[model samples]
Target: MTPAQIIQAIEGMEPAMQRAYLEQVKTVVGAATVAEVERLIADEDEDGLVALLSLGALSVFLELARSVFIAGARFEVKAISIPRDLGRFEFDARQPAAEQWVSAKAEEIRANATIDVRAAVREVMGRRRRAVVWPAAQQVQVSATPMVRTPRQSALDLLGRVSAQTGSRSGGVIGLPGNYAQYVLNARAQLLGGNPDEMRKYLQRKRRDRRFDGIVNRAIKAGTPVAQADVDKIAGRYADRLMKTYAEMLSKAEALESFGAGRDQVYEQLIAQGLDRDSVTKTWRDRGDKKVRHTHSVMGGQEVQKDQPFQSPAGALLRYPGDTSLGAGWSERANCRCSAIYKIRRK
Candidate 1:
């Protein structure tokens, strides 16, 4: 049902049910409507019928789910890096050497150098009138073809200029012969979700998680003045809140393993809000199983307990669940490790 229809359903419930519905609305609907709904529900509920309105409350949840998803999805940022120095791209430019190469190659052709006398008729001569016979050298155009330089020569010229700008060969970092820009490209590509293929779906998810973690770390290091110990302390507190909230939230939606249609729509909305959205999505893709243990062992060596479901320093609002107006959502705004998620839509 539409949001308005959902609101109306809540409104029509008994007075006591209406108050309970308002509590649900604050958590699910948003801030702007909370006061209005509360006032309306309170005004109309002379007998507290609103408290018993379970169906109406559930409908509100299903409808408002999209909005929450949208807000959450928009919580992340994405970075796109471009390729440098496309192969053979330099050939397209109208540089003299490259252009001269074309002309020189054409001149090297023997037939082009030996012009035939008969072929060189004066403009005034009629088609049937043959021109005076002359040697091929005399008749041939005197224009000489320029020498075509070898590819090696062209490369050397390029290297010579580079060397001139930065001392001699030994002055450089590595004695690499190929394009060094590729390393930068590889690093950035690896950080972003690499090629969609090659790696199965799991690899893509892992790549995305790393990318997000990198972005988060970079942002935090740049802004926060806290030391590692301080940050850890902060994260610890937030994680405690996060674990509890997720436990409660998950329980509310039992057996719902995937994002349903409305939930998927909300996920897209949250992504647009500038959150580290892909991280959240990857989290779900990587670990949505209800039975999956949070902590695990690495090669059966050191046991790495899952600290908390969400990032600790980032998860502050688990204790302050309210409608969208209170900015409870923004509590996890910049550095919160909290993830916004939804059930995946199925066919």
Candidate 2:
């Protein structure tokens, strides 16, 4: 469909459709951003595409951290100042009334799970190549070495890359504003390693820490007659503690915002570089049977029921799953397989 036509389809949908339909449109936008930049910039121009797409690695890390608190967790964004050459991010977060908030949002958390790395990205690109108008008529593909890494490893590597990229002088090709880029980098990095990040591991340990195992081992070592009921009681308390601890580490918005801010640096640069602002349209491309994720059943069910239209962010791209383009969305926005299709027609 033409870019304008796809947008029309998007605007006509109900709010839920508008919100849930635009899945991985960000990834597609990222791909389109790179392609459009290559079209305008010379091959001799230093390649800054890697910096553009690498933000996905940060996105994955933040989402995973937030998921730890998905089930009724709460957090508040607090403003803070830190030195540059660290990363770009200024807002800090605190959860003052977390214990109270968890009681209310349990349903929302249980229903929404962690977004998938591949699927989250696939939706951005959608499944099919969108036929778009360019200076030269042709199809385009974005080759981003999908940034997947072990949790600790990803945290360290992403922080290093972000610091290095943000630390560089601003006037260069991948233009991050000099004064604020470092702040944004540090803010995003801090979210990945926030109290919640560490708390997530601790909460899990509350349920399965080796202390319980040690109880069993010690009983046998001491030649103490350990009753099966007593062992079961100890294990049960671990489960109780795990749940209690999870409730205590309420998730907040700081990390998701930081990740998106990092993404925004690249997207804004590409738009300025020369991708047609009007030509790019948002359309909801269904994940189809091949890409449907079981976790996103609530959202996926709707996409499967009918043809979902795409909703463009106008110029603003979606940062993460819960982020919406307009006044629309669904309970199952997380891990949605649908993509937000963007087409660039040079006018």
Candidate 3:
């Protein structure tokens, strides 16, 4: 069949079947080729995408190549600290372990952030109450109807519901305004999901290893290729480095996102307590380290009223750091370490 016909056939399959078929193709041609195929398909280069696939008539050659590559990959993996008997060279059992570790770390970070947020809010509220003394009559009236009396259990229940909700609402979780609850939920979800761009980079590096060039050169020079066992021995030398780099990036991004969610939850609660929106302000504070992004560094000490959004130097409007609200891109939100410092101006 023609390349376009092959593309159409693949596209017509069910998603699960399509994935399975593509995975088989990847084994034969490698991920770089598969990625190129996907890009070609997206760009409507039907003739280009199936150049590798069009060699399907040479199934014997394809299978031999697949076996050779897999043997080399498996041999390399066995020499490493990774678990043996992974069944498929491409399916590393350690990947799930990495994801699980990130998930657990995110939960821990979220919990700690919640504690810090609560303490900060309490300290601010206590100071405000102590500094403002009311007249006896007003004190009696205020005592009769205390502000910020939402029960902890009730708030938690509302938070659970709001977080699970997919739609944006004007108010949520005891009347927090303007999709604040949704923002927190979205951040948490993004954290657990990890960054797709980072994953793509990892796969690209794995598929395009320069070691393959040396293997091909040797194969061309020597009339016979190296033994599969020998190729496997050296092929996985860099696996550990790639895995470590990816894990670190995922962990850091997840932690930042979870912590940001916790801070957002605090702000939502404070807003629910009926503070004067006009009197409450939030200031962006950058860590000031060299690692801070240029866009955020310029945002340091930028203050906005409770209802207003902070405008980043890149012109992205954010409700807070790590916020995806207002359609902020991954570059603007991922691994963000800045924070919002809130203040209440008493009348």
By TM-score, the better pick of 1 and 3 is: 3
Instruction: State the TM-score for model 2.
Output: 0.23
Question: What TM-score does candidate 1 reach?
Answer: 0.17
Cα lDDT of all candidates, in order? 0.25, 0.29, 0.39
Q: In model 1, what lDDT does residue 316 have? A: 31
Candidate 3 positional error at 6, Å: 54
Residue 97 C-alpha lDDT in model 1: 35
TM-score per candidate, chains pooled: 0.17, 0.23, 0.35
lDDT of 2 by residue, 1-347 (tens): 33233223222322322222122222323243333433322232212323332223333323443332231121111111122323453221223333232332333332222122222222222211222121111112221222222333222211212123443211111111121222222222222222233223323443344555554444434433233343333433443333233222222222222222232222233344443445343333444565444433223222211112323333322323234423224333423334333333434
Best by lDDT: 3
- Candidate 1 lowest-lDDT run of ten: 116-125
- How well is each residue in 70-136 modelled by candidate 3, as lDDT tens digits? 3323332333232232222332323443234334533543343343333322332232233222234
Poorly placed runs, candidate 3 (over 4 Å): 1-240
* Superior by lDDT: candidate 2 or candidate 3: 3
Candidate 2, superposed: residue stretches over 4 Å from native = 1-265, 290-320, 324-330, 335-338
